[model samples]
Target: MMTVFDRRSLLRTASISGRAALAAPGLLRAQALDEIRIDWATYNPVSMLLRDKGWLEQEFQGDGTRITWLQSAGSNKALEFLNASAIDFGWTAGSAALVARVNGNPVKAIHSFSRPEWTALVTRADTDIGTVADLKGKSVAVTRGTDPHVFLIRALADAGLTERDLTPVLL
Candidate 1:
């Protein structure tokens, strides 16, 4: 699977922490950044494949660089890690990345993980819900600040509805 990269705050934190691998190549080249931190999520098969194959480790082995795997529960957690300087790279949806950027996270999208739409709205087969419009005034469980949340927002908007039309139970 392919992966997306979010370049963290290199200019702002590079001077103080010497941790700017994601910010730019020059900063990393200038410093002895021997470790790489990346997120791993079961929901993301691409990340899981990378972890399982150890391909990254193989490539960086000649440099004696270490690979650290951080498990991210969702895109929100991945963004949090990126902002907190806990990880150098993370996997997040395009929409979530946009939201993070708008919310003051100095990050740049560097790749596309996959072409698949990773989230959708669904209900039990027995439920009467059949379409996005049917979701109005309904309770939907979603992980806030992630792809699902963004997808829901866009879906609602496309259906001529707003978040106020339904109860969003944030997970």
Candidate 2:
């Protein structure tokens, strides 16, 4: 059981200027959030930066928020944890988020944390393949409904190929 003071402290960091504080009237008395916890899913540098810097913890230490780092294997796994209430917050890709939404997972993207394109396709140098069209009738490996999947779909479309034209292996 959390005290009213604890809840107010937990919610204090949620505001930038006193607006969020002013907006919610006696929110702590309502929620008793003395033991509020947040779960984080981090697989990249920005997450690492936030964690390493202890920004969130620093903000919540006074409020008694116990920050727990949840290691997730992938977006799908992260979504599973979220659905199970094992995590309160997560870092996921846009495509993965959409897939989770389509699959009935309840989540909202509060921010876009990254915008760098960070994936590519490669083949053996001796294969002699010249273009995306050459991949038809072949097998493509990608995490389904993820960025790689979307990129593959676009590339294949550019080459006049559909998923039906080849085997898509989800990884």
TM-score (all chains, Cα) for each model:
0.76, 0.72
- Assess the local accuracy of residue 91 in candidate 1 as a C-alpha lDDT between 0 and 100: 85
Which residue pairs in model 1 clash with each other? none
Model 2, range 68-136, lDDT digits (tens) per residue?
767776677777787888875666778999989988887766545446556677888998667888888
The candidate maximizing lDDT is 1
Query: What's model 2's TM-score?
Result: 0.72
Model 2, stretches more than 4 Å misplaced?
Answer: 1-43, 114-116, 124-126
Candidate 1 lDDT over 1-171, as tens digits, reads: 455533232222222232334456644465655898889898876678667877667656776878899999878889899999998888888778888899999876665444756676889999999999999989999877776787889999999999999998988
lDDT of 2: 0.65
Model 2: per-residue Cα lDDT at residue 14: 37
